[model samples]
Target: MFFIYRLFLIILLLFTAVTTVFSQGTTKEEKRTLKKARKFLANEKYQLAQANYLKLLTLNSKDVVYNFEGGLSYYFADFEQAKSVPLFESALENSKEDTIPELCYYLARAYHINGDFEKSKEAFTHFKPFIKTSTKSGQELMKQSDYYININDNGKKQLANKNENTIIKNLGTSINSTYGEYAPVMKKNEQVLLFTSRRENGTSKKVDTDLLPYEDIYVAKQVNDNWQLITDKVELEKYIPKDLNTKKHDAGVIYSSDGNTLYTYKNDLIWKSILENGKWSNLVELDKNINSSQYNIPSVNLSKDGNTIYFTTTRKDGFGGKDIYKSSKNEEGKWNVAENLGDKINTKFDEDAPFISDDGKTIYFSSKGHDGIGGYDIYKSELTDNGWGKAENMGIPINSALDDIYLIVDEKEKNGFFASNRDGGIGGIDIYSLCINCPTKIINTINGLLVDNIETPIDGTLTTQLLSSNNPAETTQSKAGKFSFVTATTGKHQITVEAQ
Candidate 1:
């Protein structure tokens, strides 16, 4: 919490707040460069800041403050371990707070990001005894690190997808690259696939320090069960001239179930774009009721009915970093104030990339706070009258030792998709297809919008039903008046809606 508050305000406060504490000898020129770099970080200009940090390191490679801040810029911006690891290592070597709580925690985390699980484990375990009694949040991070290291050791055994009974397939070259491509969402007809990518798309003019550009929204269509990338036209990929891309992070997109209104994420902000006459409209930020650009709204998902929006936000009032929150769109077209999903769904660490399946009974999300294998493992929680049931880690093939997030299950429930940076061919984060059970079930799908008798938009106020002995095999709630459900192959499925 303080990191977000302090990091963003580094420019105005660093000289007074941190520079004096660590008096690393520096020349006047280096000090000036340090000030400039911190200012770049303040404005979210990461690339320039990284370059300045490189210059500062030339002056003082072991300067803890400079190394830490430089590593932070790389960590937060492009996520390049190559750049962040050494800097963080230097910071740790020069840090006096190794025995202290937060300082060592970051160093351990940096090691985790670098895929050095053994080193990460050593760092965390070295300070484990001290960390547990320090602070609640520090204790939480320490506990999570143990699980991360264990996953690293045991992750290779997961073969749920390799057996003849189950299958796992990467979305392949068209949809992936040496860069990251993640957060897959499909329209009702399965005609379009919208995913986020950070590859060189010949669109964005700006690239962060690691030479990778910002995340951009991209669209691909299915052709014979494969995604076809139309290299000629990138729907909303333009980054120059400050149009849709805004020269910043814009990814994590989902649709209105009808596949018209587009929802996007840019770190802390949530924006919507509508398809007007087959062209996307300008991005419009969600009302302040749901967004406070000051807080982070990293990932978002909507129920099939489009009545409610589930998002992970670092709102100040939350239990920790990024908590899942939801808001309903009333009949009057006004969004109700957002509400946190409570302690069960959130933790002392970050929780993000919430995906509520077709029937609304299942919710798949990613969390660093949960007792998952590592980093951010995708977990599933079911909603009952009592509230969300205890979240169960998806386990094995669905998760890995590295980060896995942004899980979305289709209405059919037989096949699903999730994003993972697991050790695989495609670089960064790639989307993977998961066949639910060993022998797949026949998935007769039904999805559409929900509305009141007057045809006015309805959200959480209305509930839909799919009648059968195995009723509502997969259910998704309504977000802003859209809903979806899937049933069986041989059985008849009837759609019923009632006001709550």
Candidate 2:
């Protein structure tokens, strides 16, 4: 009897060892894929990282770490931000206490971004006790979370009171792409439109500090009272001012009030070019007083006379991440040292993309602070006789739960242009035409089969990337030699195949 019991125990141990080996073999591919995903996440390539995580989820959907990381990837991505909610919830349920300390915090943010205020507040409450305010980062997190909580009431009120009278229409795929499009400025006559875009075909085919495509200024003209983009790359080059768009980061800030000079952002500084004889002169950097920061100065606006420049920068000694400052030309025509816009217009969070009204008494800007619903929201403040008035949110349909910025209105405020990354758009951060009181009316998927030289479909794990001259590459993997790629803009595509 003792020998039989010992034999049974030995067989049970041997079977357990065999099962462990099989499990490791099955998960080897997943482990390798997870490493790639982590690398992409570290690089801030959220979309690419989520793709890898999704592949891993297919191998083990119940993985807590995979779901947690996947949630973060979608949360930081350009569009489809609401997809993070389920992923976060799945991970939160299975994680041990404090094992994933910020899980609830991020889940709360996902809920807020998705406009689910009740769940957001609940998740935020659950995460609040874990914050250690002794540390600077923790203090900042606490402040941010408190701000979100306070704004929930106002955000809900604003959503309920959406202004249906206003009509905001997207500029369409011709002017927008999968890459971010923003900082839109139109000529006073509305005959010409200029904006900044990040695309594969941008100045040098190189990425910016964010690892995304570098920004480039693009120009479009109104043909027969209808806006038309220059589809031909050569024609686009002809339309854009010579040497205005460079190999480095460049974007349209604002045109000079008289429209003869163009103010632009280049390499974290402000630059200007004069339009002479239908040509733009070489770029000249702004005075050190205005371009004071070694860090980014992402946006600027000018008073109607163009004497005063209002800009946002991340220079130290500011109110927060990016503060608003103004520099005016002195009597000798040199810009005076910049002065902060003050607490009335700035906050502990980022504030940017200021648009000074023609009257110069009002400024419309985007803010991640204030009582924003979730991400950056458009707000306006009037310069009262006392001082700058309290910032008023523009309300829903114009200010979404996502980023909405770069609002430039005409003299009458009848029509204008802004940019947003809100859902229901054709691409990331599409430019939209704004009509205050008027009416409004609002990707290519590629399928491929991997084949041998003899045109026979090969069955194996294969990676494929769709390359476009005008857009970034889209990647996908297939196990049965079948793959598909969905691109942002309409353009010719080339397939690059790699065997695994």
Candidate 3:
């Protein structure tokens, strides 16, 4: 009986040894396959690499490296929607070490790319702590993931409350093409649409076509609701300085309320130009108070009085990677030093693309820090006498799980334009306009009957115009001394009643 027991133990030991050797051989084979797959990925042969990684997964299903590589390959091959979840899930669930955090981050990113926002949020929450110690890209991905989850929970409604059942029609051939057209900005009147385009024009020199250098800013004017190309008026090509004409990147711009001062981002700095005598003068760097040596200031918003400037900067001492900073003109006309808006407005993520309403009470901006529907969603916060209020998501149909930036609202028209790289776009990014549901209320009005040195109602001889302290150009006339106007915005205005 003792001899039989010893023989059984010896057989069991032999079986265990054989299993160990076999597992080591499989791990070696997987490492080799992963090496080959990584080589293919580096060479841009994503399809081939993906196939090998998928095969390796069958051999060693618990290999975190293999799963992560496979997820990357899937992402690069645009198979993210199909393969990302499994690769990420396998990596997260079966990882041997405490690599679950990194795995969760990747899984969240994959879910985000796959449009599974809720799942992405769950993964992100699991990954947040690890993000602080990970690579820069990992941190950025985590921030983006968190943003999408937040948008899904809080801002989903605002993003979806657009014209219901209206299939988002393409802006048509005039506004769209096989190329890219995006980041549309318009004047207060909504007649002029200034957008960025990568169309084939005379400036289509292939100096550096990898990043699409044939890009140019284009303008289209709406004449009777028909858009007509009007790039000639602005002479966009002429404004491109020799240094800024790099075929790599030269496009984002925002015109001031008066359409004279223009702020644009190019080559990691905000450049300012004035439309003097209908010609663009030399481009100059913005005030140092509004700029930083660390991060680029890509977007800017000016208050109606042009005294307060809000811009995005990646400066150190910021809340996160990027934060919004405000610089205002003091009583002496020099800009006060830049001040952070603090925790209420900024997050430990990127906050950018600010747009203050004409009334100065509502502020619209894009943030990766705030809870958003996706990549970047527009958020609005009201300015109380105390400080900025908690931001509210602009909501869906307006917001998507894609990058949405550069929002401009025409408070008078109850319509606005925003930039998106969402579905139904020409390619890359495109500008979209949708009518907003803006309810107007009547504010108390003070009226005066102008007469020619007599207490009588003047007919056709009295001229009445409304003027505001903030906007000098926003003037509307009322004839015959009987002026009626709706106060859609809240501000101080003077009604001048005079005899002409």
Best candidate (score: lDDT): 2
Stretches of candidate 1 off by over 4 Å are: 1-166, 209-211, 234-243, 440-500
Question: What digit string (tens of lDDT, one per residue) describes model 1 on residues 253-282?
Answer: 778877778787765688888776657777
Give the Å error, residue 43, model 2: 4.6
Candidate 2 lDDT over residue span 181-229, tens digit each = 8888887754878888887787788775556776778888877545676
On TM-score, the leading prediction is 2
Task: Provide C-alpha RMSD values for all models, in order.
Answer: 17.3, 12.8, 20.7
Q: Against the true structure, what is each candidate's TM-score?
A: 0.59, 0.74, 0.60
Could you tell which candidate, 1 or 3, scores higher by lDDT?
1
2 against 3, candidate with superior TM-score: 2
* Runs off by more than 4 Å, candidate 2: 1-45, 59-63, 92-101, 131-140, 223-227, 231-240, 293-296, 314-318, 330-332, 439-500
Computed on alpha carbons, the lDDT of every model, listed in order, comes to: 0.67, 0.74, 0.62
Clashing pairs in 3: 151-371, 151-372, 151-373, 158-395, 158-396, 159-395, 159-396, 159-397, 160-396, 182-430
How far is 358's C-alpha from truth in model 1 (Å)?
Answer: 1.7
